[model samples]
Each structure stands twice: as structure tokens, then as C-alpha cells.
Target: MPGKKRILVLGSGMVAPPCIEYLTRNPQNEVTVDVASAADLDTHVAAHDLVISLVPYTHHVAVIKKPDGMRWLGLFSTEPASIKNGNIFDTLCHQLAKLLSFKPGERDLVMLQHKFIVEWRDGKKDTITSTLESLGDPEKYSAMALSVGVTCGVATQLLLDGHPALRTPGILAPYKKEICDPIREAVACEGVKLVEKVMK
Candidate 1:
């Protein structure tokens, strides 16, 4: 496990070949891909340390909640879901559809939230929350599609490089500077401007 990396890619689709190609080029990495359905999720996902879902966005959250053996997942979903929902795909679909249906010239958002609580030596307590929002190009990159795609690619690189900062993973919010800043820069280079704001 120290020298080699295992990556599992779900759903063989138009996006699968390129990601598979990129990972396999590294001799230390082994990539396995499958057309997995919801019924077969836990079994298909249990083997790999790093998982990437190229399936429809609907299946992304389902891949994340399994507390079975795994280190991380690169989920393509644009919305968040609660573990209690049981049917993650259905809940996520309803959220995704609303975002997609926004009219041109209406701002679409990519929001990230980080919640922190601290207890001081004096027994004082503090709760802090930081929120980041990246607004999309209303006319061109409608629904922030360009931003999301580029951010997903950046996340893959972060996982491949073994970035240790996001070691504790469930859903990766990319709210911190390490993840968001690079992604922000990368998307900017593509000429799809992402206007970002932060609040605490």
C-alpha cells in the first residue's frame, strides 16, 4: 500500500477513458473500472482506496456514505445529502435539477462551508463557520458547469498527489485554501471566470 495506489472508477462512459488513461500511465497505480448500479455499490466500492465516480451525478453521494473500508472518493455531485436520507440519489437529483433549471443571466453558485468549534484553556468556547461561494458566468458557463468540471479534475490531481490536508474525508467541500485556491486559479485560466466570496 505504500508504493502502489489503487483507483476505482465507477461507470464506464465518455469521461471514463480519459481518467483511466491518466491514472494508468503511472506504473504505481492500478485502475479498475465498471458499470456499477446502485445494488452493487458497496461491493464494487470496497476494494479501492481512492474512488472516482463517472456515473451520472445522481450516484455520486451514494459512493461517499459507505463507512466500509476506503480512504477517499471523488464525487461529481453538485449537491449535498444527509446519510439519514437512505436514498441519496433521489434526494440529490431533486437538488441538482433545481440548479440546472436556472435561467441564463441568473447567477448559479458553488458553495462551500467549513464549521469549526474550539475550546480554550480557560473553558471558553467558540464556534466559527466560514462559507465560500463561487458565482458562475450567467450567460456562458450557465449552471457553473465549467467551474464544476474543472474543480473535479483538480480534485483528482489532489488525490493522486496524496495531498494529506484533506485526510479526514466524507464529502469534500473544497472550502479551504489548499483545494479551492488552486481550483479557482485553474478555472480562471480556462477563461471561465468564477467570482468568489468568503464569510465567517
Candidate 2:
């Protein structure tokens, strides 16, 4: 997916810089990098092979669907239970509240760990069950996968490893089951897939 084809990344902000770095460094050999607001999106969609959206979750709806030829990747936090389920939403809110309530000095690695777990449980609870129940559909379930399954690290790895198409170009799920235990490892190994897709 390289060689001068138009690659427009839709954002120039803190959330987008990391993926930007990846694309700039990787060099898709004809890829062009352009940044613009969500408002100017329709103007570029038809000319591009991809649109990496780093917009806020609230703004995600504006760009979720693009022209038939273009590929869209949405980068946002995997929290707050994206599906329309009240019980799941409440659980995420409660956990997020706990993370926010931690005192300033008290916000150590452990607090981050707790935050990670809360985020995981919020997504895992749904993803695992969905997959187990045979209710997983590539098109329908991809939103959930992007929200809970993919992480920055995993996304990066998928691209660097030349396996970008393996998943739906989303973030990797946070570490669990001992394989992806360390946060650094999680980001490095799996989260890169999302990075490569966006930045590339």
C-alpha cells in the first residue's frame, strides 16, 4: 500500500504524533502525508487509499464511513463500552472514576496498572463473550475489536512485521494471560499495527 498513492492522515495533535512518527520513518515509497480537520474530509476521501482518523471518540461518527475505495482507521481510547449497553457503560464509568480519584502523588505505576485492568475488563467482558458465542462478524464486530482488541503497540507490530492486514488495523488489547504482561511489551509488540496503519 505504498508508492505515491495519497495517504491523508486526518489530524495534527498529541494523539496523532506517535503514529505520525511511524509513518514518517517507515516511508511507504510514494505515500504522501497530509493533515487536516474532520470538516475537510469529504474533499480528500476519493483520492486516498486510506484515512487515519485520530479524532476524539465523540467526533468519530463524522468519519466512520468514507467512499467505497478508501480504507478508514479510527484511533481512540478503548473504553466506555462503545456498544449500546447500559450495564457495560456503568461499569466502565465506575472504574474510570476510581482511576480519576487517585491522588496526584498516589498516581504511581500501580494506579496505571489499575486503570489498564479497568479498561481491559470493560472491553474483554464483551469481546470474549462475543467471540465465544459465534456472534463475531468481521464488519459488525470490527468496531468492538478496534475499541477493545487493538492497542497502539499491537498496531505497530502488525505493520513493522508486514502483517498489517491480519487484523482490522486497530489497537491491540492490553496485556493479559502473561504473554503481553508488561505495558511496554504490549505497546511494542501488538499496538504498532494501529500505528503503522495510521501513520503509513
Number of the top-ranking candidate, with TM-score as the measure? 1
Candidate 1 ranges beyond 4 A from true positions:
36-40, 57-150, 184-200
- The lDDT of each candidate is 0.59, 0.39
Q: Return the lDDT, model 1, position 112.
A: 66
Worst 10-residue lDDT window for candidate 2 reads: 108-117
Q: State how far residue 132 of model 2 sits from its true place (Å).
A: 29
Residues 46-155 of candidate 1 have per-residue lDDT tens digits of 87777887754433433346544122231343435434357656655545444445575676666767776877899977776766566666654533454454455556
| Distance from true location, Cα of 20 in model 2, Å | 0.4
lDDT for 98 in candidate 1 is: 42
Clashing residue pairs in candidate 1 are none
* TM-score of every candidate relative to the true structure: 0.42, 0.35
Model 2 deviation from the true structure expressed as Cα RMSD, one decimal place: 17.7
Tens digits of per-residue lDDT, candidate 2, 58-174, equal: 222233355441221212344343443366544444444443333443321201111111235456421111111112233332232333333432354344445524444455553
**TM-score between model 1 and native:** 0.42
